[model samples]
Target: MVNFSLEGKIALVTGASYGIGFALAKGFAEAGATIVFNDINQELVNKGLAAYEAEGIKAHGYICDVTDEDAVNALVAQIEKEVGVIDILVNNAGIIKRIPMIEMSAKDFRQVIDIDLNGPFIVSKAVIPSMIKKGHGKIINICSMMSELGRETVSAYAAAKGGLKMLTRNIASEYGEYNIQCNGLGPGYIETPQTAPIRTPGHPFNEFIISKTPAARWGTPEDLMGPAVFLASDASNFVNGHVLYVDGGILAYIGKQPK
Candidate 1:
């Protein structure tokens, strides 16, 4: 029998106050995993707690910045003490800056890289040792479609996600022997509060995204639930060092020819 059950597992999803991260955590809870999440501040953590409670999931929420190495290390230790050794980790915390490459300041570029790329590195590093000792683990990096494709006005975001893709592969390479499977979960243009403005009907970007996607619509947070659970569950034990892109076939299809 293919085992997709996450029972007895503890999952730590970073930046799960809302958006995709929250959805993923909720899915894990549905699959029987104890959910633990973190946000950058107390307010966000509180919000996340409230949201989880509203959903009937008693998730443990914490305030920790994923970019701070020491803070992440401490957070991991605290989770180990409070919850249990995390069996699954989802590095879902990140930010993007859509400024054109030429106009984007170096400071802004570094900020994107630091949060999107380095943050995962730090958090993953903090958790791997315990995972190694425990004999098995799953690390899912929340990558992006930009990891492979680039476009105008998103230079920094593209660069960060590109680096993150390689980082996901490298972690899998370096830790596979320890029974740790590290992979990337690349989401396509998802329908979130952040994308609400652009998704209005007839909006140019909305039209562009719909035309580009073979599904002819933006993906919902629900679209990623099953895939994320598969990657986090034992069903993907043999799947490592690969990226599972949930991009509504956008990556696989070329846009329709002009009528």
Candidate 2:
């Protein structure tokens, strides 16, 4: 049987205080993996801890900035010491700036790239050596739909995610021989609290999304859990350097013709 069990695994998900990252970590815990997560501050870490506890999951939470190379290295070392070698890593920490390209400042653009692209590079670097030694590993980069498509006011975000897509492929190329699989999990417009306002009935943006998607609905955090688990488990041992987009067929469909 193709094994999908994450038993005896240690999974580290970044920025898991809430939203998609939290959902992924919760799923991992349910699959028998020991959960380890990090946030940029103590408050978020504490929040994540409480959330995990409320879900009956004993998760290890830490405060670490993924964009800081030194901090990421140290965090990896600490996790290794405290929770066994990290068997799975989900680079889920990122930010997006939706300013138009001309209006967006270079500083703001760099910030997006720094976190979405470089942060993954830093954290993945910190964990790969141990994974190589251990003979197998999985690294899932939380890429976005912007990785492939572009929108009017999301230039920086699109650029960052595009770079991340390539980074995911490159990591797999460089480390596949070591039994390390690096892939991208690109989520479509998911229904998170942050997007709740825009999702109300009759909202133009909501209608736009619903019309564009072939599935005719927004995806939920739970929609991503199974795919995350599959990529993290032995079932996907041969699936390396591929991006599994959970975009509800948006990427595959063209919008409906005007009535």
Candidate 3:
């Protein structure tokens, strides 16, 4: 039987205080992996802890900004000492600036790139040595649809995600010899609390998305569970440098014809 279980493994998912990160970490827990996560601050970490506790999962939570290289390295060291050497690293922490390209400030652009692009590089770097020593690892970068397609008000987000896609492939190329599989999980427009307003009936953006997507709806956090687990487990042992887009068929379609 093909094994999909993550028994006896340690998974570290970044920015898992809420949203997609929290959901993916929860999935790892369900798959029998020891869950460890981090956030940029204590409050978010506390919230994440409570959320995981509510689900009856005993997750290890920490406060560390993925954008801070020193903090990420220290966080990895602490987790190795406190939990175990991370067997799976999920570079899920990210940010977006929805300003138009011409109107967006250089500072804003750099901030998004710093967290979304540089952050993954830092966290992944910190964990790879341990993975190398252990002789196996899985690194999942939370890429976005913007990695392939661009939008009007998401100049920086698109650029960062695009770079992340390449980074994902490069890591797999560099580390596959050590049994490390690096991949990207690109989530489509997900309906979270932050997007609740725009998802209301008759919202132009929501309608536009529904019309564009073949699945005709926003993706749920639950939709990412299986894909995340698969990539983190032995099920995908031979799969490396791939971007699995759990986008409800949006990327496969060109949208409906005009009315």
Candidate 4:
């Protein structure tokens, strides 16, 4: 048996319709785990279920907004009662709004924080009790490069991700006695629909990112799968509260020219 295999785990991936969430869900299903996938888009949710069904994998989809506490709790309860015990929970739903700090309205800032930060809090609170009862579980929060570094025009996103990092640590510390592990995956500018607009031909920020990233290339969704698989499986049973950066060495440099 492979050391990192999740053969009998029932994995629940939020926002599994596309991007990193989709990749992680499919990967875990391929690794022999049953998947309970959720997304805000009904079309994507159905498509995800169909994809796994065609592959003869056990999977299902639920359309629920992660930010709604009652909805999240009900969904988790239904999954536990019907689908199976979710051995691993991947909090991969996130959004970014680009606006200058001074021009950003309070509504916009709060919106971002509600989805990126509070959404996870609500979902985790809903699912963690069952995990505690089970005495073993894994929680992988998808953070971002901005978690540690500061950037302009995305203050709310930065704050939410930064908060998520500490939340992961707190959860790990609080739950480690129950044999549960919590960790984070921070991706830097991965190639996905959310990033496409910014990297288009004439986008001013594209060149800046390329120059700043030591790899000189944007990361793809596949770039994140390995980290997710590791952190979600028994391979990382003892690894908790770690914010593993999947950036292409971009955070290492201070943008200084070589002398």
Model 2, 16-83: lDDT tens digits are 99999999998898899999999999999999999999999999999999999999999999999998
For candidate 4, the per-residue lDDT at 157 reads: 94
lDDT tens digits by residue: candidate 4, 1-259: 5478889899999988767888888788777788898888788788888777776776889999999999999899899988888899999888889899999999999999998999888888888899989989999999998889888898999999999999999999998999999999998888888778889765778888887899988999788888888998988989998999999999897774855
Error of 4 at 156 (Å): 0.7
Report the lDDT tens digits of candidate 3 across residue range 1-259.
8899999999999999899999999999999999999998899999999999999999999999888889888989899999999999999999888888999899999999999999999999999999999999999999999999988999999999999999999999999999999999999999799999999999999999999899999999999999999999999999999999999999999888787
Q: lDDT for every model?
A: 0.95, 0.95, 0.94, 0.88
List the candidates' TM-scores in order.
0.98, 0.99, 0.99, 0.92
What 10-residue stretch in candidate 1 is worst by lDDT?
A: 95-104
Question: Worst 10-residue stretch by lDDT in candidate 3?
Answer: 91-100
TM-score of 1: 0.98
> Per-residue CA lDDT of candidate 1, range 51-119, in tens?
999999999999999989999999999999999999999999999887888898999999999999999
